[model samples]
Target: MSITSAINLFRQLTVDESQVAHQGQPHVVNETCLDLLLIEMVQVLRTSVAETSFAVPHGGLPPSDSLELPQSSESTTARSNEEQERATELLYYKVERVGFRIGQRLAERYAKDRPRFTDTLDIVKFICKDIWIKLFHKQVDNLKTNHRGVYILQDNKFRWLLRMSGSEGVAHATQQAAPYLWFPCGVIRGILANLGVDSTVSVKETNLPQCAFQIKINRAV
Candidate 1:
């Protein structure tokens, strides 16, 4: 659903402010708090992954083969490459899991008063409008679906990336920024899962601050 439409719908569904206030004042926090937390989270996860990746097993004893001879340069490089790839994967997993739990909790809170969603499209629209606005302070810029089971959500100015930049070229900047999206991808999946949808969410960034999230519903058991 477009933001405008969503706003109208929200107005119709919303309760009076005075009534809501009687419950409690809405919680508010500095937006930068989340941004800073995310930055620290990624760094901490990366460090943990690196340490785990290189930690020695068997009480820190060197392998018997390592005592015999140094590995060839090619073999050593290959091993390093493998370790780096594994570390990256592990980092993504950790960050995404955090996001998944977050999304689940947020869904529980936000979906409390709403009527049960009618279908998959209804759920997706809720994410595009209410969820995005709640998290990012804006609705998704564009939402596209294949009328099958695939939906693409594009944000021209993703709040998380608005202030982020890289000294290197665009490609390097993109690579650096890629990990940040893993958490949100997990969040989307978590939200859907909580809403009774099974799906896989992935992201792509060709330009800074402009990214697309593709959510593919998993129909197979």
Candidate 2:
């Protein structure tokens, strides 16, 4: 099966039946069907590091206005704002853990079909989608390339300005702020390493007033 199919199946089956979107008419696999979809998705990431093309950069991406953060002088005392921020971080961490879990399962499934990008980065996309939806309960629009060096995986439902520019300086930001959900590039690097890519990673943010960014991922020496 294609990686997209595998991911949809995993997400549909792994999630609670009630959580499944009844609006769409995708085939619903029985919960007892612990098939190889989960296995293939994980294995692709394990043995294919140097051969992947996503290791290089691609172009033609879109802007994610949600990625922008709030001003330093502003306030966020609302109970609901606090809650959404918490939910975003909680789900982000969950996705990171689940990606590793998925990768482990995939290594076994692909003991044979291990060739090129077809088996590696494609499955990572699937993993990203599954983890994203399973946690946030919404789809994140995937942006691969645009404006050169920027790609965005946006929260479909949570469309607020997702500014991660000044996350390090948010003195009031406990583990509860949106910046926790709006993770820095370093977090992505660590997540990628845990999945067995074996690469060094670095992150730098724009030092603008409130419009900061933890952009730039450099491979280490």
Candidate 3:
């Protein structure tokens, strides 16, 4: 669906009398604002991890003025590699946590008026239609499942990645954009959790604006 169409739908959805009285009129946010916010959030988290990882001790001299013996190049490279991995892990945890909470609240609000879902597939369809439209302005392009608790949701034009590109080519851009997917993964997980489904959500993005989320439900014996 077009963004304008989605905004119109949102307007209709937000007209609950109680909500209006309690929260006032729902505010419309520019799509670009959310995009920019996500970009800036990732940057800030990365910067925070870098600063924390390399922070100097209060009583110790700065790197340039330190009198401590220098480590070998190999040791330095290994430490750098370790720090980079740690930073990436930390970034994913922080971003996903934020999205998870958002998804939980969104599911609670949107699913309240809907019929009770009958099965795991019913919940997945709800996500593909209602929740996806609410967040991405469109329904999922496709959904596939094996009847054994695994589902794959494909979006041909994922809104978040629509404007992302790099001069370094598609592969490079895809690599850089991978981190952003963590948030949506958390979002899907949160949605499922709130609906009483246990699952894990992962993403695969080999091309621009096209991505697939894999949901693996954990059914009890």
Give Cα-based local distance difference scores for all models.
0.78, 0.37, 0.78
Candidate 2, residues 1-221: lDDT per residue as tens digits? Answer: 44455544543443344434764555556633433333333344322321232232122222223447553433444633544455444444443444434444443333224354342244345434543444334454543434333334433333222332335555433222333223323333444444444422222222222222222223346
Q: After superposition, how far is residue 104 of candidate 2 from its true place, in Å?
A: 9.3
- CA deviation > 4 Å runs, candidate 1: 1-20, 23-25, 56-68
TM-score of 2: 0.29
How far off is model 2, as Cα RMSD?
18.5
lDDT of 1 by residue, 1-221 (tens): 23233223322323335456686764444667667767777787788877776676223657536689766889877867766787888899988887777777667767878999989898889999988988887899999999899999999999888878889887888889888899889888988999999999999544788999999999976
Best model per lDDT: 1
For candidate 3, the C-alpha RMSD (Å) to the true structure equals 6.1
Candidate 3 structure, TM-score to reference: 0.82
The local lDDT score (0 to 100) that residue 4 gets in candidate 3 is 38
lDDT, model 3 = 0.78
Can you tell me which runs of candidate 2 are displaced by over 4 Å?
1-124, 146-150, 159-176, 182-191, 198-217
| Structural similarity to truth (TM-score) of each candidate | 0.85, 0.29, 0.82
RMSD list, candidates in order: 7.5, 18.5, 6.1
Instruction: For residue 21, give model 2's deviation from the true position in Å.
Output: 20
